[model samples]
Target: MNHRNPILFEVEKTLYPTVYTLWVYPDLLPAFSTWPPVLQKLAGGADLMLPGVAVPPSGLPGVERGALCAVTLLGNRAPVAVGVATMSTEEMLAAGMKGKGFAVLHTYLDHLWEYGDKSYPPTLAPLVPDPAGKESAGHEEEQEGKEPVTSSSPDPVKHVAISDLSLKETDSCAELMGKEELHESRAAEPAEDASPEEQQEAEDTRTPQEQMDALFNQCFFHALKCKVKKSELPLLTSTFLRSHMFSCCPAGQQLDIKKSSYKKFSKFLQCMQQQKILQVKELNKGVESIVEVDWKHPDIKAFAVPEGFSSASAAQDSKSEDREQVYHAPEIIPLYGVSTKMVPLFQESGHRKGSVLSSSEVRNIIINYVKANELVDETNKNFVKVNPILCDCLLDKSEQDEISHLKWDELLSRCLERLQPLHQVTFFGQEPVVRKGNIEPIDITLAQRSSNKKVTIIKNLELYGLDPQCVANILQQKVQASATISPTPGAKDRVQVQIQGNQIHHLAKMLLEEYQLPRKYIQGLEKAPKLGRKK
Candidate 1:
């Protein structure tokens, strides 16, 4: 085996190093360090852009185009992100350090990072030039004898950047400190005293953007650090903003995105994204969701409030709720009506007969029955041999039409016939899930991202008994594109796999030819539709 780097580390049959970060050997790969924002963006599955990169006074870190390199954050030597250079270091400088620099594959805090040793790279003084790289877009100032910093204000804790100031925060701070004097003033501000009315008036002078930013910051902090449950991650973007985010906002401040410079709701989210506070994913076409929040953000730690603050707010909320309700609504009760009854074709250890199950439940039980009894045909993975249980559950009443060997999809649909009655389980806000004994089809959508780039997202594969990790590994090798496996939006138990660019046609072929999956189970193929014959 040619171990010329890009090593394939496997566990059992699974290729655990499915991402580029894992492919590159840590010791052999050349490294560079930049600001946290750059590393954060890389970590969030973004390609590194030129402006975001920092260069030592000595010059760009030498690397060839397509060469794998390790990226570390300033103030820390740990290589938190790994990327393949899109342009050579010389070409990068020749191009005036513009356009794409590195295509990031994997980074710290990503799924692959968590899968590994979680080892921290030692302080990388190796890449450190005779001096050091310029830091944070000229935001940091180095002292004569002090260690170089990513940021270096006297009170680093309170010194928010001028650019970071919204209309509300900046205008208020300006008006309070004398509006005209703000730009003229140096880093050191002239201390001044103001009456209560003056302070309130100054606060009122903040722009709507400022107010929204403050509100959004507070809401985001609360939602991540307090309100959200550990179980509710990769939360749907809409639900978080609409439900949890608004509730966490300071009392009396309506969660309205229309009031700010970011008029569209997604625009407001983009602003938060620009700040590197959270990671958003376009899991489906026209649907953007907050996939991850940076709970370990310095801001979260710096702005930590007393625990009593939440308790006090909770008390006030309870009192307000008690006073606000004129009449209580009826409690939601699980109302079960006659629906569908199901039976397994095979009576395995846990597969019992004469039990009433919803369509989903029955589907689950039948799948278990098929697997437990080892009914699947060994020669071809897609076909399952009919046993007495499968025959009873799937066979037609007429013996002549009895099919002894059944495809997995056919077997599943046939089993649904024996499920005599189906029941509906109504959720709080969703359509009642009917035990229809219908197999939930897989969803493949072309999702659009920034720069009009498109990604092909295949979801709900878990329903077909496909292992998500295995599927991701196969796609990675087959397509030669970046593939990320994540939890499907709104469904935690199911997983979705994504590939860069439009892989619809390729995916369809892969599913049909490679995996032998039934075409009837896939949806959204029409969006990509087959192309006509070439002239």
Candidate 2:
């Protein structure tokens, strides 16, 4: 068959009814890189021209005939002029389209020819002489007087005098014709310099729905080039289908048929499963495993497993058992010493033994006797002790005579005079001091000395009218003498009493009560004696 007439012979067998319509925006030009090499080459070489035709501007000097131009057919209308450029042969060469333009043109023409009766405007029939008429002898008389037509100067070919196309038509032929007309009108408009903002507005006029259609066309074209069949096209474009099958399905649900990689789709399904929006089951199918799932019929309770297998329940039971096992035994207490064993003694009235004793006991037993016997000095009010038991047993006949007429102070002074000579007497490795009518217990050796005989006599001064001060003073003197005379050499042997001045006053008050002395004498005794009596 002649290559020029190839469409006439080949179109019936090869042509498909469905045609892909693609639109290119300025910003999306880069995405052309993603197109198959054939498409990229076709798009790069194609110029902006009238739809369904490849014609360059007549006025341009260097323009060549049959050079490629992209004539945009807008919604089956006449083609629109957008922008024009020279073809990209390098891109075409890379795509193996170097000498293959004829092949592509033939393919395109064949599609038009087969579908043309159904697609072309009724008005266009008048522009082309009937092929049957040309074959008849009537066509020879029409050319007999005509000058030979040159390719450059043939009478300007009459444009098909068809009515402009409209998008409102339901028929496919009418839609295609409408788009062709629309494209031509757009191309004929004057190219005034438009502001960027105006250009942007023009660009933005195409809606998202329009863009989706363009993308679908691009995809369809690619699939067609791969030789996909008419029935398979629906499945491939099912993502744009309005059916429940695509809408209700989970994000990553892989249909029975596979094409592109489904890794992203698988991840989407897993996410849906986690959210309880889908349910999946893994089925072992030979070496490969297949997952079967329902996305719309999600099980809400799938995540709520029973308590026995749950970690939370086990932790709670363990805590409860630990609390139950904690021991709370009673405390043990032990009894110790006199605090637990002794019951207290009580008086006949039920008051305790020592509790009932008062100041009356001391006044009656000691104070009244001293007062009645005039043992304490009345003029000086100086207190003295006169225990009758000690006086009768220890005072001897001669010493008694000397002290008998003296007042308690005078008697104490005389006792001190007599006892001074016995201060050197030693007993139990200690020397004992002596005062006239006062004595303290010493060892047997000191008790045997005649000079020390005065020791027991002074001890008996507790029986006479002797104050505890006089007794203490006399005792301290004796202890000092013993410390001096004894063979023990350490300073620890010295006797000292740490009494504060206020405590000495308190002692005087107590002595006043014991001896029946008046407060005046006790007051006079406040000052301690500065010097000891001369030896």
Candidate 3:
């Protein structure tokens, strides 16, 4: 344990014959030694507020929400308590250091400490006499210029009505849970025919807001102006409206949603959608949520920060400054000189027979065509009955006569065959691109499958721009075998063509002799001489 790192420590132990060291992390909330009474409260499992934390010369460590961090009381660097961060580092900084900080989980005096025979932290700094907790509370109240309301429980959390200066999201969460029940009860009561006292009582209960209508408008605009980000859409309806917008109502005025004319949350959302400000998209079959936002809306434009606030010249000059980290996408090597073939249904549909299409585009066309023609099986869509167009497109004449039913994936393989060989290009890396027209060394490997069945895999043939469907067809004819596409482990972007039988001998011959790829590019050919016979 040292200045920077205090809580983390390692211990060596032996079980039977073997000895090993293990690292242990305990719950200890870091605090300034300046505040011992606060540490005492924390030892009793009290949650920490931002105000109680003393900012040392070194700022708070970068901690994400839900990550466990040690709380080291000032002077002694050893952690006294452990807690989980309530908000992310960026959020805490953006919030100007106000509100709750860590939600304390465990401390030294807790039961967990009883199991360990550990020494207490060494105190080096002079211990100051503890100040009265009430006096500090009074000082805080005076600073905020608001009287503190006491709860019956000793818990630090205080619950106040909407009439309070600030209404937090945590406060409204419980109210929203019981909104429906309250609405139903209100309808059951004969409130309209009530006497003067009852009417006055009702009026008293409903805290009067002179700008109630205007407040809703203000909150709606405010939520959009600040809380809602352009990137967050399509937002979830329940999450966006009820959780976000409802909480944005000005402090001291609760958003009385029942008073609004809209009967339900969805009705209000529908009205927004109808106005074309944003579209509501149902995800996974009618699970409604805010799915889109109208970035170009006039109201949104008005609320948006004006462009060029930081002039282009200033931005250019400050390029070397330590700005926030941004993520840049990994560059992809572009492929050119590719073409695709048309399926039988679209053979004369004007798509060139040997033209090229991306793998995804080809898939979309096939699936959409199947759906539009209603060719999918009524019982199981995966099982497609042999049709003339499919027979011409997917299966060879030999296969057509022998097979009456085929799986959907097999058809996809045939579709992939129509694409012209793709030639890859390098943008900024040292990696060489095998000539777009030339075949690369065939990557061959042996692996065990379920039931201990061993299989041989061959890949890199596709990198030569050769149609995988054509290779599979040739393999089936020459070696009397079948193959399937297997996603390569550790390389998510690449897939290897897998053959059921160990066709290493044939696959190597096909690549070396038939494809005429340079011998230098070929790998594992020395092992290819062994007869890959079935066990």
Candidate 4:
């Protein structure tokens, strides 16, 4: 017997060593610039540590967890090593710049680099300002009056530029302190205290472009930290601008990016990318997408939204969400209402003329009233003696028998019959609504019409405060059937919905699930055909 097999890309073989001819395209992954000694350690198969990595002043490049990244010497843009990030850029900073930073897989001196053409990293210009140079210059000034430190023993933290990690936060704190001091100084000066008009004039002194730029930056950072999420990433730039950033602007203040100094959306994105707020890439030709975001940036964390800004947008979102869900009427139950004639008997039980009670409740109240008044006959336990309230409520004038007593069943029946009909509709999360009228059960009937065709007819929906036309539209959409609404025959100002075929299954789901109507209130459910049975 002969067997046939096939192989995919030859690149898979060298993947374990992280070396291939594919490395020719150096910009394949996000590059993190660090010192040469750190690259040497990685070459020896040691994992990169956060303390050893040199972060530029602009900040670390935005990278997600486990994403492929390149490592380069601080002065050179050429990557000499390849690895996957152990965590996102924000997480690395959150760790206080301590712990493993990258899982190094390939380096210049590793076996993989030897397998390919053995070439050394080229001497290239640094893409960012060297933090070590600035630190050394500052350290010299601090030690001027103190002991003179020799250049032979330099601080390792200063050499590796680890101080850059805290630079952004320190600068932000200084800026805030500066603002506070300025306010205090103004308050201390008697002539500097200004009126509202003066403050307005001072604000108006700023150019329009400067004001627009400040507003643009505020909304951008606000949207990134508050409104946007990692899960919603790879979002289109246009959507981020309009749906998120624009909506976050103050209600009366419009956000026109064109008015800003950057003048173009692409320019703004490029500036943010340089600051490491986010990573924007062109997924498709000429279309930019935000692939990753740095949620823990110091600027984003420090930005506080102005009070009441975007309040209208937030409220509108909640209202729109509520509107999306259909409001289902409550389950309605019939009960007896206390008419003017029946008020006297129920009044002693704390029921007024408009009070409504169920049959059992009314029976219990009447029994209690009889027991409290000692109206039960002494001779027969089954008969209740008539009181003036009972005579006025239960006995009619046409019956002049002047009946002094009545049987227990007769008395209860007369009370219930004489009481006015009422219905109480109870909705979830709301109070029950009681109205004085009869509520007909929603009637659903399945019958054969022309040519033995089946039709489902629904009636009495309006009696429960439901519109037949609305119900018909919902049922038609749900069942994918033809539905028509017409005036109910022999009924005044009432309508009925008629749907093609026996749609009882869909109607049951709509009524029980969507409308939340009780099963007892919907009539003719048994008429629906049983499931999984042939006709």
Candidate 4 lDDT tens digits, 314-414: 43334322321435566677799888888899989999987878999999999999999999999999999988778888988865367989999999999
Better of 1 and 2 by TM-score: 1
Output the worst ten-in-a-row residue range by lDDT, candidate 2. Answer: 23-32
TM-score of each: 0.28, 0.17, 0.21, 0.35
Go through the candidates in order and give the C-alpha RMSD of each one to the true structure. Answer: 26.5, 50.8, 27.6, 23.4
Error of 4 at 383 (Å): 3.4
Most TM-score-accurate candidate: 4
If ranked by lDDT, best first, what sequence of candidates would result?
A: 4, 1, 3, 2
Q: Which ten residues in a row have the lowest lDDT in candidate 1?
A: 141-150
Residue 466 Cα positional deviation in candidate 1, in Å, after optimal superposition: 32
Candidate 2: tens digits of C-alpha lDDT, residues 81-181: 12222334343434332222211221112233333222221111111234353333223322321221112333312321112212221233433433343
For candidate 1, the C-alpha RMSD (Å) to the true structure equals 26.5
Find the candidate with the highest lDDT and give its number: 4
Model 2 residue 461 lDDT?
A: 20
Better of 3 and 4 by lDDT: 4
Which segments of model 3 are wrong by more than 4 Å? 1-350, 429-439, 442-522, 525-535
- Give stretches of model 2 more than 4 Å off: 1-203, 223-535
lDDT of 3 by residue, 435-477 (tens): 4443445577777889887677776654443334345545666
Q: Cα lDDT of model 4 overall? A: 0.61
Positional deviation of residue 234's Cα in model 3 after best superposition, in angstroms: 61
Error of 4 at 103 (Å): 54
Q: Give the CA lDDT, 0 to 100, for residue 145 in model 1.
A: 11
Error of 4 at 416 (Å): 2.5
How many residue pairs clash in each candidate at the backbone level? 17, 38, 27, 0
